[model samples]
Target: MAVQALKDYKFSPADAQEKFHGAQLLYVGWDEHLMFCAPFAYCLPPNTLFSDLCQKFMAHSFGYHPDWKSVDFSKVTWLKSGQPWQPDMSKTLAELGLKHKDVLRFQTPGLKGINGTCS
Candidate 1:
């Protein structure tokens, strides 16, 4: 049922595997007194099917309080993407230099050496 609702959702991704392949629940809203669904579901996307299961679990889990009127589901956010991991300049350059001793010109072959190095 919840899965169907997710599919019907506008922002929800179609074909969970493709769009939400690496989708992860960054943080599940926690209910202090344990009012609803434990308010927590931090889990790694093991597989595509697991992703769907997770979505199903998150969509509708009002546990003890199953009130459609009193419940506030305004904070259920699917944090699929995370902070961009910036490459360490020093490490990256060092690795690159070590990996490829010959740094080919990014441009075309004819312009290999536009300077005096060209034969």
Candidate 2:
């Protein structure tokens, strides 16, 4: 349901890209992993390489999960903003067409949380 404003509302969004200096806002999530509860938000430079993002940022964010060790990037299914995506690990986020506030979700095949409970 769309929200209808009872009165004229005009204001800038606090989370706009410009508010983060040169960094862009990115959201990443692991599918069927409820341990995280929600996606992780990151403020990073657009020039950050996809490989670095996964090896560094994602590792730090989701590394504690039991399934993290089993995740194989080659076999994982990736989705960008809810659509299927095949990212070039060698390319930077900007080269991959990822913009501020974009969401990247990855689902590891044969892995669905600990004991397949989606926890």
Candidate 3:
């Protein structure tokens, strides 16, 4: 039963692995205290926009309910290699010097901006 449940899990990455082969796999996380949440691994396309990635994180990590739409994109900030990730001012992942398994920290609205370390 447990194995079957794992197979049916909503966030399964089996398909994504096949589809995004050779794509950079980035670890995205919402900065949280007490380690209450888990970071998401994304198979980011080479030309994916920063804004689009932010939206995708919100939708997938937080769920796509009607209430999620009210969240402001302006307050969304990402940190890569300890530097701020600007959506409007940045280019693609490859252009931004991001490699596979790079961890990007996300600072969301209403959450105190605290950097969390991934082991």
Q: Which candidate number maximizes TM-score?
A: 2
List model 1 lDDT by residue over 69-109, tens digit each.
Answer: 23233322222223222222233222322111111111112
lDDT of model 3, residue 84: 82
- List ranges where model 3 is wrong by over 4 Å: 1-20, 33-36, 64-70, 112-119
Q: What TM-score does prediction 3 earn?
A: 0.57
Candidates arranged by TM-score, highest first = 2, 3, 1
Could you say which candidate leads in lDDT? 2
The regions of model 1 sitting more than 4 angstroms off are: 1-20, 35-37, 42-59, 72-119
- Considering TM-score, which of the candidate structures 1 and 3 is the better prediction for this target? 3
lDDT of 3: 0.62
Prediction 2 global C-alpha lDDT: 0.93
* Local accuracy of candidate 2 as per-residue lDDT tens digits, 92-114: 99999999999999999788887
Return the candidate ranking by lDDT, descending. Answer: 2, 3, 1
lDDT preference between candidates 1 and 2, better one = 2
Give all candidates' CA lDDT scores.
0.32, 0.93, 0.62
